[model samples]
Target: MNSGMDPHSEISRNLRAVYQEVESEEIPAHFLDLLEQLDAAERSQSKKDTE
Candidate 1:
């Protein structure tokens, strides 16, 4: 059943708008610190696996 408007296009437009809004926001400092901690843990694990 065609509704005369493409639902897929409407969804794509909404998703793009949401993405643009999110991209403009600043990341919190605490979140950045957490991410850095995670990266360090991953690197430590990788070094252990190689040895």
Candidate 2:
């Protein structure tokens, strides 16, 4: 919600910030899979709520 950041871009930025903090060897494939699922669920829930 900063001056130049749109919601989509802001989400991307936040994801990059989190990714940077994680160790490469410690990263799990399921983490990315779950992130995507969670993101989708959030979007779906928001859409449902708005309606």
Candidate 3:
């Protein structure tokens, strides 16, 4: 197996496959809500520090 495939090409193909699989996944709504909460907290902290 993989006798004639260039090593670089093989690596590239594998990476693309993995990327596609990850890209097709659905992010949970709770994860998105958590991210929003984190952003809000960071902004609040930044504002307090500046004042």
Candidate 4:
């Protein structure tokens, strides 16, 4: 189970980190898409788990 902190906030923080790296041109385009997909999947799974 997830802990005390807000899941959306955690997701936002992780997305922010990815954005910072992408802004620096550190991550590739395909990798960025992959991460986005993964984030989407995680959110979907979390929703299912909550239900």
Each model's C-alpha lDDT? Answer: 0.89, 0.83, 0.90, 0.86
- Candidate 2 per-residue lDDT, tens place, 1-51, comes to 568657478797797778777745676889999999999999999999999
Report the lDDT tens digits of candidate 3 across residue range 1-51.
766767478787898889989888899899999999999999999999999
Model 4: lDDT of residue 4: 69
- Descending-lDDT candidate ranking: 3, 1, 4, 2
The local lDDT score (0 to 100) that residue 19 gets in candidate 1 is 93
How well is each residue in 1-51 modelled by candidate 1, as lDDT tens digits?
Answer: 975666479787898789989888899889999999999999999999999
In model 2, which range of ten residues has the least summed lDDT? 1-10
Give the Cα-based TM-score of candidate 4 against the true structure: 0.47
Task: Tell me how many residue pairs clash in candidate 1.
Answer: 0
After superposing candidate 3 on the true structure, give the runs of residues whose Cα lies further than 4 Å from its correct spot.
Answer: 1-23
Give one digit per residue, the lDDT tens place, for model 4 in 1-51: 866667479787897788888787766789999999999999999999999
Q: Could you tell which candidate, 2 or 4, scores higher by lDDT?
A: 4
User: Per-prediction TM-score, please?
Assistant: 0.51, 0.49, 0.54, 0.47
| TM-score of model 2 (CA atoms) | 0.49
